[model samples]
Target: MDGRKPTLKSSQKVSLLSSSVRTVIRLRRTTQVLKKGLPSRDSPSKVLQRQQSLGKVKAGNQASFQGSQYFTFDTSAQPPQSIKKKKKRPKNPRVLYPGCSRKYLPTEHKSKAKRCLLLLVGIICFQILNAIENLDDNVMKYELDGLEKTMRREVFGQALAVENVMGLLKDYLATHIHNKPLVISFHGPSGVGKSHIGWLLAKHFRSIIGHEMVLHYFTQHHCPEGVPAMSCQLELSKMVTEMVTQAEVEEKIPLFILDEVESMSPDLLDTLGGFFHTNQTNEFLNAIYVLISNFGAKEVTDVLLQNVTMDLLEAQRTTEHLRTILSPVLSQIHPLWTSAEIVPFVLLEKSHVRSCFYEEMMSEGIYPDPNHIERLVSQLGYYTKGELELAITGCKPVVGKVNLL
Candidate 1:
């Protein structure tokens, strides 16, 4: 009694534990018997061991059990370590080439190419400018404007002829080079100023480019009556060769004028023709040949007389018509005229003769009087058509007439 519970004897405790184990074994045998109706591959001992392990593990982790399978969870177990995604690095362009400091682009090369192109353009521009300046220098040496003004002021009633001659001169003299000699043939009646134009051209050229550079050969004066055509041809050829050769050496264009070519023999004409050809020497090719002839005087006069009243436009047409009519006739006379540039000098009108009289008087240092000029113009014979009167002898006798005054 003292308040303590009654303690069982050791033998009684042992007998009670044995009876409990026997009761458990009996209950397991009964369960096995009951489950024997269904087939089971597991032995009773293994099934009991698995059940025991399941009960211990399921204490802390969530788990599910099916009829034959048992699932278990462990809360203390770590989740599978999350695989960290690796970040990809950007590629470097310099890795493709080692030890090269320049960029992969063609920017520097393209810049160099542009610089070369600009330099080439600058060189081309310089060459063009240089050529233009040289051309200017060649043209400036002639002083052609002064020549044009002098011709216009001195040569009267021949405006068209002056303009045409100036145009041809400017074109030919623009360059010092030539493929062939320029052969300008003046066709007109006597006293219509054919020889006068030739003289003026020779004089002007002589004043500008020395007298040796100009050869004004008068066929009649140079080859007088009864002279042998052969001797005259040889002499003429010698003179021309000397002049042209010397002129070529000096790099100067020479003027060769043959007046009264109507009287020149066939042999002499042929020699002159040889000089005008493209196959000739450089000296001959750089010369200007002016041939003054009265071979077509009758034809030129007849054509002008046919038009009762003429105007500037009609005059141009008449000139072209005269050229067409004269070309075949002159060409038939000599082959030299075939390549000649035919410049037709028309009949001088009565008014032109009057002006000529006045000019002659002034040149002779005599004052001019209108009445005296009219009187001088009246002395000249005219081929009249309506109010247009063309002088028959033109200003041919103006010098003699002024001398008489």
Candidate 2:
């Protein structure tokens, strides 16, 4: 052996390497193997892509220090997507009925014409008391008598806002008079315009001495036998029909107001439809029937259920969307049974509510703290301006009270 160094055999040299040294050698070998397995770096396009990708990033381009670096993109290269515009909501217009406007707040309609309205309200109250199984005539009279025009309008508006109401109305009408009676279902969410408009039309008709007295106005809430609980629907229906018959034979054509059809069952719907069309069968009761409901056809197809809670003004805004969902409800009714009128129940929305009533409230100093007042006013959020005013002032909201113009 020379003075430089002594050479060992392969096995001996491998054995001489320490554990850490062996690991380093193995890592080097792995690096060489990986390098051989990597894609070729000579491809110009590939090299360019890598460089470009790296160029897209910079250490400065970071959302926060805690997060990893992000790439700065040339967002200007592509224009931002345009956002769809929201539909402009219409303002709250003037209501026609007394208490339909906030203007009558200080002087509620009850104070002006309680005696006259009492008879009309009495008819509704009496029916409702019977429906709720004589909940209490005294209590019913007090509450029913107190219901202003605005309350009816709001409840009717919310009811009308339900989907497929238009189609249902058509169907109900088709099956009833002359095999398509003037009788039709005015189906919608609760507090929609069905009963309200019915009440309005009845009131207007009553205002005039028409051959057909606006005699019987039946609503779901006024179930004389506790029908609101869903268990007593049949009893309620029978009670309603009987009342209509009485109204027709005694006062005028039995104008049966099937209020809150949404609360009734399919059996009730079919039965009512059959009875309305076949009242001619008995030759004793040829009532001019009107079935009102918040149930729409589309609600059947979709698993979701939108409650009948929207106020009058919201109905207008959501009517389109609701209609799509209500297509099925329309299918349930006959085509000819369209609503005599597809009126929006509540004409006033929040913008309208504030504009129509709040300003008036401010002028009158109805309550302290403007902000607080607004907050309290919107607590339920579903009731419309008419309903809200009806509560606040215990009066009906009319078109003249909150004229859109």
Candidate 3:
């Protein structure tokens, strides 16, 4: 006996190799099915059992390995892979400081002026709206359009004067607050509609603003020749204070008309001047004063008569000149006229007097014949200049003349 191991035949070795390859292929297929989560032909435990038995068979069959060592596959049961959880980010992550270990979030800056500016703008807008409302409430109380229409229709041959008066009234009455009372001094010759305008204003104000709110003071009617000047001054002051106080309580502006002011005593003039003073109460300041006078009648007439051809521009210039001339003269009389708005009344032509007669006749319910009106106008005295005859007594005598007709 030589004690040597016997070698297998080539055919037997080939068969053994084929059987091992088939067993390895089956095991690999089973592993792939399990990874894909598909149901395998055998359970995991059964598969493990089968693999163990095959390994045991290969170990027992030592002739298959001959004498060489070969690598063995571990088929032990492995725990199923556990699912890994992802880390979550925090809401406010902190960063380390540049020079320190402390961490903090960046601070945000805001402005308070923006909010304050918005509030300021809102306040300003509110004030403007309030002012506009006040202006509307104050101005709408008077029907200025109606007053203008009345003046245009009733007043004759004083277009410039009427327009100036209306303009002043509009400007003064636009607001209730005034630093000083409005003093309008009407200067012209007698019978040239100065007193007539005063009368019309009084009547209109009485109709619209209540009778108690309007005061018509005539120099002769209120303070006659027998009345003492001091007594007249006291009485005038008392009446004005009462009217103004009542008007203030009612939140209204009163109308004060003084006719024949040229004949008023200096004391009475001074008393009236106190009402138009700047350093007065709000009640006294918020009033309309119309002074009817023949202060510059001769000068006004001479200026109008000299012009001969008075257009709109020429009339405006003449009025300005008259104001300049009359201001000093009136101021010399009393300081009351210093701040007054002097409106010069021009002479009424013969045609204007004829129109006045026609209106008077129609108003009196008498038939207005052209020839009758001409004769009535001719009966009135006139001042002739450059073929232009102006009525000396405007519509003053028209009522009396019409009554006789």
Per-model RMSD to reference: 12.7, 38.0, 16.7
Per TM-score, the best of the predicted structures is: 1
Taking all chains together, each candidate's TM-score versus the true structure is 0.70, 0.34, 0.68
Q: What ranges in model 3 sit over 4 Å off?
A: 1-133
Winner on lDDT (1 vs 3): 3
Those runs of model 2 whose alpha carbons end farther than 4 Å from true positions after fitting are: 1-179, 187-195, 205-252, 278-287, 297-325, 330-348, 355-373, 378-405
Q: Sort the predicted structures by lDDT, highest score first.
A: 3, 1, 2
Clashes of 1: 0
The clash tally of candidate 3 reads: 0
Model 1, range 1-405, lDDT digits (tens) per residue?
Answer: 799999999999999999999978867775775588543345789769867987888853433343225555565899999999998978774455565565566554456888999999999999999988876677667777888888877776777777778888888887888998888988888888877888889888898889999999988899988999999989999998999999899988888999889888888899888887888778888888898989888898898889645579888888889899999989999998888888888888888888888888889999998887887788789997887888888889998878886
What TM value does model 1 have?
Answer: 0.70
Off by over 4 Å in 1: 1-129, 308-310
Assess candidate 2 and give its TM-score to the true structure.
0.34
Task: Write candidate 2's Cα lDDT for 26-106 as tens digits.
Answer: 667656746887544346785578668766665344333336355455545988789999999779976576665555456
